[model samples]
Target: FDLWADAPEEATGHQPQHLPAPKLALPGHEESYNPPDEYLPDEKERKTFERTEPSERKQHWLPEKFAALRHVPAYEHFVRERFERCLDLYLAPRARKNRINIDPDSLVPQLPDPKDLEPYPTRTAVVYRGHTSRIRSFALDPTGQWMASGSDDKTARLWEVATGRCLAVWQLDDVVEHVAWNPSRDLSLLSAAAGHKVFLINPKQLWDTERQLNTQNLLSTGFAQAAAIASDEIMACRWDKPSGEQSSQGILAVLVHQRDVKQIAWHRKGDYFATIQPEEADAPVLIHQLAKQQTQRPFRRTKGVIQRVSFHPTKPLFFVATQRYVRIYNLQKQALVKALQSNVKWISSLDVHPQGDNLLVGSYDKRVCWFDLDLSTRPYRTLRYHRQAVRGVAYHQRYPLFASCGDDGSVHVFHGMVYNDLLQNPLIVPLQILRGHKIEESLGVLACQFHPSQPWLVSAGADATLRLWC
Candidate 1:
């Protein structure tokens, strides 16, 4: 009989599959029904062993000294352990990653180089140094040749931009809180806000004889109608003519408020202006018409503490910034248009774009936020380059430049290109950081503004100096 040939056809190269026995089933000293106490671990050692990973453990099972086999508990993880063993025997290990055939550099957006975007304020050109105390605010006239500044020294000084000469100075009874030049070139008028009043002063010497006469006549004609106007028609402020020494100093008329005026913003036409008395919660914002000599409270009750107010360049929109929000109101409709949430702790300054489609906000949280009005109410970009609180922010009227000044004693200039095509997002590139003023008494730059016609920037600092960056 050919036994080998008949049994499985005598497969010479093949051997029986050897399946290894499980470690758990294999008998060892740990599996002993009644192991010695010395062979077993104490409670602390067992806890340490339990905490150790299963793969890192010295043994697969713990040693237990039981009095009887009936006291032994069943192995809870026996089925799981056997299943894992079966998987290891059947399945093969694998490693894979999806590959992409694209260049890494192409993923980034293309932006214009800062060097290509010129005509921005790159260096300090002039420094006006007359204020005995910190300068609070300043403005450039429509011609861009003259500048007006309010200081804590209870004075407002006019300066010639090129020579840094103090052309004139008007002393007030209290610290000058704010100052702004009328946007009208036909009239050479300046507004100064001090304690409880706003002075409409015509610096007659700054302009020619004809222009000065026209400005004087325009301001004088308002007083003739002031007496005829009813008192109740005026909201929270009164238009009163300055007398005695005030008239000689070019003070044309004074708008007296119940509370101290903190800010003054003029409309593009120069006939209308607005003032904010933040202390008065009920009547904080007042709009005044120069020709009518009337003061009107636009809002019956302001929601929050007023920080700053601004006017749209070409629209009838008025921007009122509170602690953490900027509310826009339409003067014609007398209704709320949009409320911008700045996402900041406390807003220190607010400036609308010349195109009126964007907004710039500075906050005490050391952030400068840019908002595209067409986009979300949240900031389109939140920049935090300042080491201290941001005190001022401004946008150039005729340029694609924006600047922010902070308590860190630095002014960061950026090239903010707003594209006409709505599909293309605005490109912002940091240009320069101009630093010169020394920090004084926990404060640095307090206010900043751009020139009306030129790419010049003027910043008023708590160091009692105004720097012109061109």
Candidate 2:
């Protein structure tokens, strides 16, 4: 009796199964041949192959000699074995974890042409929880009512963005690295964990969402190797329509070895998605966005993946940040529009001002950096309020205000989103600091997001606490 299966498997002919290829190392970091560093003393990590003589390398005879061999079953088997290993890797993982649960209601609606985000800081809300432990990731629902979270606490929690109430607590019992809210159904969520399995959870459960996890009664199986590439991120999984279903349930995991996808972003509207996969050295950051379904596009490198992906509130421009640098890409043109920098430690998240020309970027080392999209000579103002890493940031939609939270376990509420060229207008003035508990937890703020129609905010932290501020 599989606890996660919806129906009795033997009755339905479904069998329990395992991931097709968790056997592979890191989600995307295995090589055809991995030799020990000691095997190559210089540590150059290079491989050498003898150049074969043309006479020896060339086949003694032409295709006519092999024609007779092609008809034999043995010849066919030999050809199949050549690429079997590569194909097996992708197929193995699917068999292990192929129970994809999708709610029929989770369908993309006909969309209006995208519009520019109106400028005007509208409302400001703050969230904080004074609990121990640190938060690792945050996810937002486009409508803003629900926020799904993953943390070092080995659990995934859901909260109402309007009021930070822990709507649901999913005890994963594994280090949940990423929690992605199904954009279509805020209650429908997906989380990737350390166990190498992607768990689909329903904030609304019981009857329909009861489909269990059974691989022996497998639906489909394929291998998905996990390799520890510097920027390969199995945790940063994405769902794309790709000419099929509009539901966020449809996904196509890109095959990128030796990289971790630290940051991910979806387009304002469409089946397009992008992830920042970085490799050691100067490996190009892969930017994958929607290019209409069926158009198999190549990778769009954004210089480096040290930074992350932040979509424009209403525009097509994308803002990616680093420890001390930022780059803006004109999505329509697929070109680099701006290169800006701030000698900051690490800008973890970027939230563009909903109404004004200002931008708020949170960092691990404290101060939240501020900048103007048009005037990119340098950061316009530095909001030096938080004393610890500020992992979550949100901009008000109508009022001239914004909010930030961090490991300090306090949500700093600021009243100004400055973009004045005269330097007369300050970016954000401290309006208030909201703390959920009198005691500060060891973990600071993990993630924060606001609902589209409410004057409130939702947040999660490593303390496994979720709070809503208004």
Candidate 3:
């Protein structure tokens, strides 16, 4: 109502408002048929017009003189002049805009120096050499005491992380594709993916009697129910107990898949684990529950070739990485949460940060992409320091560090500090490149992971060795 501004209209006189130039204006002497000599451009002025950019030029056309109106040449830019005139009449006048004089370097976020973020993996500390063939994958136990490695030599070996001593070896009939230690320290169990089957092994010799017994009961509790169910009921996988030599090798139960199992990812709780069979079109991914001995097909129909799978660190989210995209699914709601665009040709591996707010993706195109989950689906940073295909990537569980390894036989370590403030972005700094393994058959480092609790990294390579960097 009038009460709002009636007093201000008189007390504060109406502020003067600047109006734009009128759209219609009379042509000046430059457009006259018989213009003055001062209005015409000289030879030097014509040359300057030719050298200047079209957008920066003061006049669209040069002025010329004529003795008589009838003798004047037809306006060469007549059509262009008409079009510009029409545009001015129809469009609103634009205000003059001044460019921001910002320094390119000043726009960049300030990050701490790499030297200040010390204790990252710097030099090779130990090399565990026992695998006869290239190591496909390896994982460290939650306690950081032991390491399990799978290789093409059809063997899975356990090694003491500190001493690099091979404690035990379990021989298989085919190449071991992947291996992972159960996240739960009480279970002390290891899962290894081989040709068409995933073996659950509990090396009782390395664990105490109570832990061994607990693992056995958990694995064997569902045996009766699994046997009662028909094979047709669970078309994805079958849980069966190994016998004789395989049983003596500490193989608890073998999960038979329709095709070769390429990757295995254990849930944070250790009872449920997911396996990937790239060649299996119908059921490429299967989630298995240890206590119930149940295998579930997460997707009825799959998209691109499944490269790898990872479980969220603290949530009921599942991360499935295809050739070019990483999709996160909500297990409880059975809905898609987000599809992270890696923008890489072929994703080789994936790892979620321990905090579960960030993702790291390695690609065969020699690129490493980092994604902040809270930010957007696109990668926050894309790094291209690898000379060859990036085979593996990992984040330190305790330290603010991440590393990527490739066929160049070098591991590039980076200091990735994620700030607690949501407004503040992550600071990434290149720390060091640890190179020791010799390139063999064009394949260098196959996999890399950090110690669970320490500032150490263990890398498995095609050189048939695992190097420790601290």
Candidate 4:
């Protein structure tokens, strides 16, 4: 009865009181379920697990709860090993992190560097001394081994380019105004303009002394065999004359104007040539085809006093230079394609680049302008280094070089690069100034040309000498 009475206090529906919910263990309570040192993870393992675990999971489990879980000795080692694996995955070195090496000097050899160009015509290697009168025109043979020059001496002379030795000379009836070597590698022919007639000279016949002597004897003996042989050797004695002219004289071709033909440019294929007359403002520019020996007027009438004409290196186009402007005509379309504007009052000469995308123009204002046909009708660069008017300009086919001669008695060499991309600007570097020919009175260097394949140049001047610069 008494025991039941003592438990009477719990007889109520509620259980005994929880001792005020067992107040939280005091900071230094020893009997309050303390974890063993080995059972709890070390400071290093705890920090690693904190760093490697996701942020949301870290907020869900308190640091005390993690410590309580690691309180199990077996579980503490497993937790530490998991943290170590995560560290190795993120902090370890990778194979793809290797460094790379590069070299800067590996550029294509075909492309020329502007810094390597030397712009001085310092070497006067040889002086060709055959022409007695002022040499007006000069041309390099296809092989680049020989040069042909025409002068006021009424003769066209061929000389060895390397030695300046005169190989042969052909006497003409009038002053040799212009000369051009056949561009064909298979043919050794030359064309010379004098007075109203053009002569097609065969170098083979001129080189054969026996043939010349026999021809002379036959002419003297009045034999038909000699005349037939002379006719065959000379090819066509005279170029086809205009329809109005009746006589078939012993001449290769006839100029539209009775005055001297100032300039002649051969087509790239050596099939035709163009001629211009300085005095004939009313006459049209004449184009003579070799196969037909016929002349056709490309321009029905002259635009202005035509100074020079040049055929495009690879296109069906020709350029005409007048006193004030340069015009490009399309041969196939038979129309004016472009008219290049110029600030200079007079344009003396122009030469087209082999790429057929640019032109080099020389003018009387002492300016040498480089015109980019694809960019605009205006000169891309106007260089005024020459003291006097520029007389002639020539471009090298295989090299990124060009030459200009002027009345100041100087020849300037420049490196011009026409890049493949339209966005890239052309590189023009003035490399050298060649000065050897003396300026006689007002006349200076009349013409200049580059050897086809060699690093040689030939300049004709009023001094009656053709100087070779290498």
Candidate 5:
């Protein structure tokens, strides 16, 4: 897949020249230890001049002849300053709410989650305050009401969709790397990470393995890596797609190298699953599609190891956020789609909206982004909420809201809309900042979520704490 860069248009106005510039000066100041024609000291020169001044030395006034040099560079800095300030003064008033203020609270909003306290945004409440193994990650359902979290403790927990109260716990033998919920199923969840296996659990059917099996495999499984029960069809992954003559229970696992599986996730709504095999770079990792009946094609192997996959909630689109880039794909058409170049070194997290209009991704940059699907130019808004990598992101539909939690011990609530024509502000406007526990006092927030039908939110983290908000 290739990146889509903005097409260059014709020049806007007359071209400027590249001749050697004549030094800037006023009419009277011609030669001698002359002030720059621009006269004002640029920021750099002014800083140098100030840094050289002796603190203890007192300045003696020079005779009128030398008075010109006395003004010095800092004085020059005061004159020119930044040209943008003048442009700001001229432009701010004429701009719309999006341009006038970045934080949506300063101007207008289409829908604001009332739970968000504005101004200090007030950190008035403390939710679940305990957990161990450093809450490495967390996730909210596509519907936004329920929450799930994974920790280095080697376990994943399911919480009351609204209360942040632990409803049940599923244990993994290995340190959990990622967890996900099927966008179509509210009561079901999946946990997957580096152990070379995936788990599926249903709050209602946790005890009903056979009954759960009866549910549509799609109802049972999502694309694969973090295998959830998919639609009722026969679901299995075998390095070898079973031959028609051979009678084998639909294989349950895909064969890979001895131990190369790293991270994998399901498509938001489709049958396609994306995986990141354990190769560093330039190695080919397989990404395959499993069909319903026995056309029996071998699993497809493509170039490049898959790093991570995220699907559009309601569209036929899915994205692969990998070591090289973030690629959009049309699984049905089996064709490459849009690809976006991310400023972050490596993308650790990816989330899509129910409408497939916007995407949120977290990377090594310690920032979160809101990207408009229609506009491939760049991120509409970037959030500087964490000091380290952002491990997870979830956007609440029906409201201008989304939440992200990271290693920095904070969960940021973003409130803003995507602009199609002009990006005037950070699409993500931080509304509430939720802090995880200090290593000393309590626990941190590993993940956070919005309620599906109510105005509630929940979070989980390393402190072994789970918190709920309303």
Candidate 6:
């Protein structure tokens, strides 16, 4: 038996049980129970829907009793205003005050029209620094491979033009006054002037033998005698110096001048060259022939001191710059062709154009004058751009351009056109002003020349540097 005994149950099969319904509180309450009409009033009772006065509409929503608080105390308002004023004083937008008052047009000079000036040559491609003293003169080879420089340190150095590598260096007994490359295509040689001696050098022979020493394995046993002979030939004329040493030798010819040579100019054919000496100003210009290694007097005595001389590129004519005149002489006829009266007192340098129809003269008065040989003795255009006395002048052989360097430590390049027609005035446009070489103790650019066929320039400065600009 289970804990509890089951009572007898009545069985009502599948019948559902039902409960009584909920009763309403009151009869009227049930009728009024519509949720008090959702507690909504008429449209006039709603503040947002009611009409408002214009002044009331602008006022902030607050109790009317708080109007006195809205009108702040005068002293408190002044203190708050002062605080905001201080903040604004520090935070306001500032007006920029210019330190320099400049006129736009005066920043740079108004360049000439019709002829476009080239961009300035400010990019220095190479800085050659082998010269111990001021570089007095330098010349670019016709092939544009090497440049030869002469310095006051009594040395003449050959440099690979594109790389600025020193290939060979030769020492001299005195200051090297000038360095020039043989213009002849057949002869690969260089000429350097020191005191009264001019040395002609064959670069290939010197450089080729120099490169052979490293490859010969000279320390080996059997080839000792051959190496010894080669070594003697290398040192035959004292051609080379130890590394970092300055010495000179191995020259083709050394021509001695009677007096100190002030300037040297090569003939167009490269077979002959001329030298000017102060002591021989009254004498004819001395012409030296490379083939015979002989010096000859070609021109008769002129009136004034010879300042500079240049040979025409294509003609047999040569120009002589004197104190007050520039004279042109024909080598074949040995006669004066024209006398260009340079009204200036001192003509410092002169250069002949490649076309052989124009000449440029630079003077001590900071003036560069261009003369048309076919037009007149007077200058067609006189430009006064340099600040100091002109030191050197050069004309590009391939371009219609000319350059002038002065003691002011500036180089000015110009485009000068000699028109074929007489009615057209020659257009003279200033292209560039190159300034890099510093003026130290009154030294500046002493010499400058353009590459024969390329748009490049090489300048020798008194700062003992050679800068190449392209």
* Tens digits of per-residue lDDT for model 4, 1-470: 67655565556547743332223335332222344445445689667767775644432221232245445343334576568667766676444334666455554235455457753345898988978889989888788877889999898888888888887777777888888876866555577888767666546533546633442332234322222333322332233332322122212233334456777788878768877766754453677666545556566577677888988887898898888789998999988999999778888888899899999988988998899999999989999999998989999887888989998899999888789999987888777888999989798999999888876778999999999888
The CA lDDT at 172 in model 6 is 78
**Model 5 error, position 162 (Å):** 4.5
Q: Which stretches of candidate 5 lie over 4 Å from their true place?
A: 1-131, 139-148, 162-167, 185-194, 203-264, 268-275, 278-305, 419-428, 439-446
| TM of each candidate vs. truth | 0.82, 0.53, 0.78, 0.66, 0.58, 0.66
Per-prediction backbone clash count: 0, 70, 0, 10, 40, 0
Which residue pairs does candidate 3 place in steric collision? none
Least accurate stretch of 10 residues (summed lDDT) in model 4?
242-251
lDDT of 5 by residue, 221-339 (tens): 43343333243212333333223321132223323322444655565542444545555342323343433311121124544445566666666766777754678877678677888
Q: What is the lDDT of residue 239 in candidate 4?
A: 39
- Which digits, one per residue and each the tens of the lDDT, describe model 2 over residues 341-407? 8768777778777743677788888878777756664787787778878877887665555778887
Which stretch of 10 consecutive residues in model 3 shows the poorest summed lDDT? Answer: 224-233
Model number with the top TM-score: 1
lDDT accuracy of residue 443 in candidate 4:
85
State the lDDT at 372 in candidate 5: 75
How high is the lDDT of residue 188 in model 4?
Answer: 55
Q: What are the per-residue Cα lDDT tens digits for candidate 1 across 45-152? A: 889988999899866787777778798889887898879778866684533445989988799877777778887888889999999999998988888888899999
lDDT for residue 215 in candidate 6, whole number 0-100:
20
Ranking by lDDT: 3, 1, 4, 6, 5, 2
Q: What lDDT is obtained when candidate 6 is compared to the true structure?
A: 0.72
Q: Is candidate 1 or candidate 3 better by lDDT?
A: 3
Q: Which of 1 and 3 is the better model by TM-score?
A: 1
Model 6: residues with Cα > 4 Å off, grouped in runs: 1-120, 205-248, 281-284
Candidate 6 on 345-411: residue-level lDDT in tens?
A: 7998888888788888899988988898878999987889999988888888777678899889888
Candidate 1 overall Cα lDDT vs. reference?
0.88
Q: Give the Å shift of residue 11 in candidate 1.
A: 33
